[model samples]
Target: MKEELIVKAYEVAKERYAAIGMDTDKAMDALQKVQLSLHCWQADDVTGFESAGELTGGIQATGNYPGKARNIEELRQDVLKAASYIPGNHRLNLHEIYGDFGGQFVDRDQVEPKHFESWMQWAAEHNMKLDFNSTSFSHPKSGSLSLSNPDKSIRDFWIEHTKRCRAIAEEMGKRQGDPCIMNLWIHDGSKDITVNRMKYREILKNSLDEIFATEYKNMKDCVESKVFGIGLESYTVGSSDFYTAYGASHNKIVTLDTGHFHPTESVADKLSSLLLFIPEVMLHVSRPVRWDSDHVTIMNDDTLDLCKEIVRCDALDRVHIGLDYFDASINRIGAYVIGSRATQKCMLQALLEPLDTLRKYEANDQGFERLALLEEAKSLPWNAVWDMFCLKNNVPVGEEFIAEVEKYEAEVTSKRN
Candidate 1:
């Protein structure tokens, strides 16, 4: 969009929001401060740089979209291209399998900070921070379980892998001068009924205790729980209850992946409860149609409510937001831009809300007035402010980013074959 039109529209939007006791400038500033952690797997459909093994562990990435990144350079280039279209500075979330190992096979347990030295240097060059995750699936030993697995030798391997990942995350944080959110998720469950539920959880708890025994000041440990996976339909060893209880008791950050819950469950409602106990929370923002499909996030009601809750609770700095989805059905870069922008839009909408007025009405027992004002706030000039934000950030405003993605695909990704 033209700069003149954006400026005019923003002026009008600023006045409109001012009438509702909202400050557009403050909202824009808050939006700029939110540094979303973009997932690296989105560029390559979770097919990491490790072996060409089939994706196991109850996870799968559908669609055969072309131009998937084949190596570290291509992946980083694709991510950089996607980041250019986004507004603010962001962090890159990396899985253990995506390390730059120089064509050498560094198994999970044998991996170290040296395997990721090139990545750290690359991130430094790009002025981007890094986050880390332990890859517990798509391996030979992943069939049974990792941390929760009863077999000591198999479990020990994964435990070692997670420890190394934490160490790597600590080093990343130390290098970047910010805490690296190291998230740990495992597809550890049974396809059928599991008889020894207590035993499995106990073993998993012990494993986590050992993994987190050596504390690092630079990295924050977050434990993620899943409802189920593709093959593990009957029971998930690390259910929501287990992780919530563990996180609260152990004072560790708990990760809430929107797709990792039941269809009818409200992820937003748990935010307040978790904030009261845990020091911090990590959010894996995604869209789940009816299950844990890991679809690209959109500016839907679910996402809106999540953002609203975060703003309402005044926990913006406490809750770390990150994208966690891989959809190969469309242009990979397009998916990244769309998901990240949608999330930012949600945050903008939340920031533009007349929260003070609404809360005052509620406190005064004026339910009808509060509901009426909220309904009226829905059609406010949020888009104008969003456009202004993009304009200020020097990115393509509105749907202009679509053309940029198409151009990239034609000139860059399409020739990958």
Candidate 2:
């Protein structure tokens, strides 16, 4: 991690890449410009400030790691600490339940932008932007279904909540001078076989139409889908096809969570198709072990493929990348650093690819050469470039961040009783 070593390695890497008709400086510049949205729930294990029941809706945070943020101040401190190790300035993704309700119960149906004024002030103070999500799980009304609930009363309650969420997102966007990406994901499904699938989807479509009835200038709306949840294995109301079709027809952005699909399903392959139709796409990058466990993301094949496809399609500006995982089993700050840095590494690798050369091989019908070049590209000195990026950003390079997280745990988080 020495300055001389970093500079020398980067020079060598630059030369090697230049030989392949790639520019390391341009790749580094592009990598630095891509801002990822860090999820807030990671600091507190999805246990928002709202006085809700245990985590439900087929989601659960599994560990009891100490030093978890007990309030907004502590959570902000933790996120800022995590950001220090990450490479670039990023936005924070907030859930409705994380609003500053002042210890008073503000039910989802009646929640408003006032509840999040403090967050907006805090984000502005830190020079950070924000994104929003409608909290549709772990509430008394979240049993069995939400927007697609059979009962009109239950469905209306969620509809109102979502409408208020969008309104809040708009205010945040206007305040920050950027469009807040408001993502709506509901765990509406059946634990057992249900015969009313069509009926539920129809209700969902109607609810979405009503929620999006009023357009705001500063917020962009996105709909997310999942394969299944813990108990909701029998049926997932918002499947991929449902959201893809709905997003296309309604002119809304579709969010693709990496862990929301089957293990064998290629999330990368879906990007090209979705990009052609949707105006934009949002990514909830997470690591799913055997199922949607929501483990912290790493530099694995799933993530690599996802980043590669995005670069291949030249969809850097068209896609919104956000980390979506909460592993309370480890140090929360470490989890954030690992996942965020790993994502950046994957993007750096993708950006360093000699796409022009590889594409030329494909265009010339040289399949074998194309395949060989890709294999060779894997062994390129992308790590040296990544180290330089961290150095330039004034963050710990390589495994040095591990010690920093430990130091914070001892000095800051461990004292929280």
Candidate 3:
């Protein structure tokens, strides 16, 4: 590791030691071990550490992660191995290896019941779990039955697929006794500003009803906060118009993508508000890049610090963490490797901070009100946290990225732009 990083690690360790009232020597020893583990895992590339290594280590592919262009078995192995990097503990609640909704266009039906059975066996060996979400049924070439067409046959086909997939998930979980969610998203929203909005409402309700009737009824149903496309339209799930439509006021929950909440609220505020409706958020943790660029960078200090605050408030147990990363610039393997490791590291640091901080508060004879006060004390701006981590890691933020962000000010930057 670089000398700067070593110093920074020591600083973090010293702060924790002081907070916990532990002897400096003991704190240093513990933090040193953590630091060394990080260095060994992330400092350099180890032999046989292929991006695909994640699955071989035992994680299962949950959703749209498989591509027509990739080998299913290979992708499955890489996902599992990526999961292995998570430190095991109830406190270390890194849920499942999550994938997006892109599989609608691919022929996943080829994997069949047999392939799922084999994969379940593989997951059992590694102690990993699988979680998945379906892409909007309306995407072109997704082969989704179109309720918009008002054809019963088309609608039935779509409903059948949903039911079959749910059954498959149930079967897998029954064997493994691990949790999984068959998440749903629909591209059903008015496209043209001049279009009749009522038509889209019918379409949305119909699709959701079909999903709700599936075999995965017992599993948690998560509605995504989308990044773009038709579903992001004014009446779509992520917009204000669809917020109520999302069943947010009901028992069903909504998932929050940290990067997706940009320009709306800082991650901390989003977490605070989101916790009210859905304690367990299906998170899409990635770097907040320019408009429409969901480049899967590791969690930065800004986001990590906010996530830490959320965890401190006991909001973590309510949510499951998913590495929702998709970056075409870097192949899937590189994206998964860097993004997964970075997220795990940030989670570790975030988890460690609060335990130490709370220990200090408790030892000081602080009451629960003081704990609330600690939350107030920890309420530093996201940018300040970002600066601290960047400084510690010697990570560079590019000027081009800054320029792209500036251009998005005052105007909505479309993905095409």
Candidate 4:
């Protein structure tokens, strides 16, 4: 009975979209090609298998949700469970600390590709690609500085760690037959004001050049910058300006974490500008309540605008999308499903936009028509089309997934504690 109603809703929606010179089928096809890289840290609150280090690097996941993955196998199981409800094939993003250490403490600099052999096998079995990040936080060596440290010995340690991470990403990419995007984000900055800003920035540039010296075929490099971290408030060594300039000069991808920018700043506004220079852009999608809280993403105005601009700029293919929020206060798997689906819904809404007609209105100088159509677009039956999408993908067609998540929690995660 519900299936008939869904098909009926879609038929009416198909006709409504067709009236605006839009094709629902085409929009769904475009969306189906997009693959979001789901971060692995969400399953375990950023506690990786490599160490028992406290979550640092100016980030915090504030929740004590039970049933968090306690081991590699458990994390993998939770990830698979979350992915089952989400439509389409998506990749998993792995932190350097999540390696299979086999209960042995392996320092970052001493890590190698062999440590992730099981991950490669696991990804191959699941038919998913992997993305990676070089973790520089929560370690004893990570004080106020790492790559940008004035101390050569400490700086060299981090440099070697990042270099080894790139090799590991290359191996994962080769095994998966896709380029692994390795993001380099350091926790190198000062809490109070610093006088030697240029000195630190120069040192960071040099360290990046050395770390990126070895070129690998299967791995791609991206540099992420932050506005400020919890303790590192006054000054950040790798500011957005620094990485933007660095990426353009070095021909590398620049990562834009939504929560990394100030609240007043609009990430959507930066895409067109960055697309003009950078090779490609990687998005670490997260919703920031006030500061860089890394709150789970929802279908809000900011996200809608961001995804809409990506489609409007005709740069969807040029931008790599990934989720980067962890909330331990709620059911971990439920958080994954909500955030991932919210992002997809936003993307779908953007895809369903009558872009051609709006562009024509702009070209013809029909200001009121453009504004009116833009406003009216919100009322379109995009939700119906979204239901159709979920139906076609064989996933739950809306609110239905809520029950599945609750069922999993009651039967599985609730028992973990």
lDDT by residue (tens digit), candidate 2, 1-417 = 388999999999999999999999999899989999999999999999997468999898989989999998899999999999999889999999999999999999999999999999999999899999999999999997999998999999999999999999999999999999999999989889999899999999999999999989999999999989989999999999999999999999999999999899999999999999989999999999996559999999999999999999999999999999999999999999999999999999999999999999999999999999999999999999999999999999899999999999999999997
TM-score of 4: 0.99
Steric collisions counted per model: 0, 0, 13, 0
Residue 129's lDDT in candidate 3: 57
Candidate 4 backbone collisions, by pair: none
What is the clash count of model 3? 13
Residue 404, candidate 1: alpha-carbon lDDT: 96
Q: Rate the local accuracy (lDDT) of all candidates.
A: 0.94, 0.95, 0.44, 0.93
**Superposition-based RMSD of candidate 4 using all C-alpha atoms, in angstroms:** 0.9
lDDT digits (tens) for residues 1-417 of candidate 1? 388989999999999999999999999999999999999999999999998877999999988999999888899999999999999999999999999888888889999999889999999999999999999999988885899998999999999999999999999999989999999999999999989899999999999999999999999999999999998999898999999999999999999999998888999999999999999999999999876559999999999999999999999989999999999899999999999999999999999999999999999999999999999999999999999999999899999999999999999999998
Give the alpha carbon lDDT tens digit for every residue of 186-290 in model 4: 978999989999999999999999999999999999999998888889999999999999999999999999999989999999999999998899999999887
